[model samples]
Target: MAQIGLFSSAFFTLLAIIFCFIFRRQAWIALLCSSLLTLGLFMPVSFGVLLVGTTITYFLGNKSQNSSKIGVGIGILLGALVSYKLREIWMDSRSLSLDDFWNEDKPWQIIGLSFFVFNAISYLMDIKRGYIKSTDSIFKLAAYLLYFPTLYAGPLHRFNYLNEQFDQAKITKKSFNNGMRLILWGLFKNFVVAQRLNQLQIELRQSDIGGWWTLLIGFIFFFYLYFSFSSFVDFFQGVSEIFNVRLKDNFHKRVYLSRNRHEFWRGWHITLNEWFRDYFFYWQMKFKFWRDKPYILLLLTYLLIGIWHGITVKFFIWGFLNACWILLEKRWKIPERMEKNNSYKFLEIGYHLLICSLLALVFIFPSLEGLFIRIGKPNFLPMDVFLFQKRNVVIILAMCFMVDQYHRWSKDLRMDAYFESLPSWKRRLLYLPLILSIIFFGVFMKGMDNYYLKF
Candidate 1:
């Protein structure tokens, strides 16, 4: 069933590529409509029924002048999303409990569902506060939910962003060149590096190793998966730009350069992080219970951040641990002058990575039991995974980091623009290698499924 579903989706994706070329002006609508149509074909359920119901509800929900009504409507959709546990539910597996109503499956089809939920709630809240005017066209609203480039793994987009391209029709050579590069880059990361590293990660986890060192390799792979997958976000964001749909870029380099936990969260998985801060955190801050006691408010904020990712026992512990880390920073009096010293700069980098790694380790183990069992056991390894290491995964990792670092230090932003600005001869030299590498890696790789697709 899974293979059948995957095969059909790939077939439809090829068709989507053709439509994208043909309907250049309406590419956003075409891309999304194709994805939605594909979903209906594979979904077994009627897209019309779901579309009509969601559209009507979204319109009626936004029509309200009262803040509370919009809040209630947003809350209901959020509740359905949460109840569905759309993130890690198993489809086709035997039911372990009654809550398997919305398992992970092509038929259930929660693609872009999380992004849509956040965007809708934001749209509702924004309308109530006058930050956004409701689009009268149900088609436009539906298109926003289904926009294909971002729907799989977002650069979380918004309606206002889409509004600018309303009548634009040109797909210039520059746009096509840049867009193809990005799409190819994304496919390379998704299909090549991340997938290969993931298999090794699983092998390390399931292996019978006697020490904490092997456990360290698990976390290293953790970082690899994150870097490779998140780069996909950049890749798609670039491709979407070619179509003139400027999707938001989700990563900020400041995460690598962050001075503290507070700064670090702002940089990582940033769209969702800021989404929580603005939508959930600020919303909670209005009350006297939260406002009067700052410490309590801080604790609740981090806890909410954790649970927003997943509602599980480990998620709560992960959230609480994060809150503790934040509160410690607040209570500690690290002098500002001393913090700037060279040693402190070193300390700050170490501290941020440790915090990120700790939080990420919690992410590794899904339950409290799983987390505890893995803790105190070192997992790092210089293992001879000959297949991966032989394939130059190490070299690939170094190159990926080097390119990212170069992008950071280089004053001229936008790699595409920078490349275009190069001398004609120099430009050809640079372009040939990038183009060749894409063809080389792309043909040989067995790409992974979208990581967020699990969620």
Candidate 2:
């Protein structure tokens, strides 16, 4: 029931691994039971809601042959999702503090409901399209919906992909080694990199630093957001792989190297964007009006994506700005034009980096007014204000950037594969420092919650 990054969740994962090996071909049953038990322990109310939602979705898919009934079912599910969003918006609008109303113990604070609901919707849609059939086995349905590794924030996998692997899933030596390596790398990113950046941001904000420091905070937040998000995916995907359940790769390593907004999105949150593209954008393109006036639909799609993060004005602005930049790039053929002059590569990269860092301000501040106030503030803080030494921060960031570049260069091969190809001495030399950094600098005591957990 504990979140994936927590020690308790790791213990549960270890147990699940042992249980799966003992059961052999029936490993899926052990997986399902462990998943359900974990969910029940962490969030019993949410777990009950998940079961009810999954059961309804399963039956609705079964009865989907009746077109009218299926329409009603789809509407009901959408309505529920909309209602949840509205309730959240209302809570945000209220004068009462969120702590006074919403908490982990509250029934309305359903963790991962947004993600699983989207999965359920996609399941029903896939059934209607005849791409996949609804299973008669409720247990399999439960396993697919409530798979523990992805039950929190997810790579947003499809039912067909996971269901096919469940029965045959088992840990091999290669998988175990790869999974452990991923776990260690993820720990380093989250604890050593992201958390330190978080501390720096907090210190800057408390100091009310402005000018270049505000811009630096924005840059810090961009990397912080990336590491906080991608690390969760890496850690959980590693755990899932140990069970031989391969989840979708969420982040492309080249995301930060992107020269434009469109290219950046293709590399960042790859699964979520693909989900919107497949289920929403393509579905709209079926209409002649949407096809003819595609940009209008594109803008609307992004607005929906923004609201999906949270029904807030700041998010709406963030989505709108992103759509505008993307549209500008497409209409002007910016990236294509820039490609002709190789000398302009740095200019192109800087342009995107600046835009993205500014856009990150929307997420880092609670309100647009607060963001402007900070940017407009005349005073500044000295480098001495950093919790971790500023020089150490720079060194860590540079190291990460260099590693990412290497990953980009070897995009054809997986990181685990590249590691395995190295001699034992080289491998030990590489991972030994990484393990030490995590052990010394990791921020495990504060909390294990990820940035995306709210969504």
Q: Number of the top candidate by lDDT?
A: 2
> Whole-model Cα lDDT per candidate?
0.61, 0.77
For model 1, the run of ten residues with the poorest summed lDDT: 441-450
Cα lDDT tens digits, model 1, 136-210, are 777677776655555556766556766565345235677767666555555555544565556556666665432
After superposition, the stretches of candidate 1 with alpha carbons farther than 4 Å from their true spots are 1-32, 42-53, 86-106, 166-170, 254-259, 333-339, 342-347, 376-393, 409-412, 431-448
Task: Report how far residue 101 has shifted in candidate 1, in Å.
Answer: 12
* Top-scoring candidate (TM-score): 2
Model 2: number of clashes? Answer: 0
List model 2 lDDT by residue over 180-212, tens digit each: 777776777787777777877777677758865
Q: List the residue pairs that clash in candidate 2.
A: none
Question: Candidate 1's C-alpha lDDT?
Answer: 0.61
Against the true structure, candidate 2 reaches a TM-score of 0.92
Number of backbone collisions per candidate, in order? 16, 0
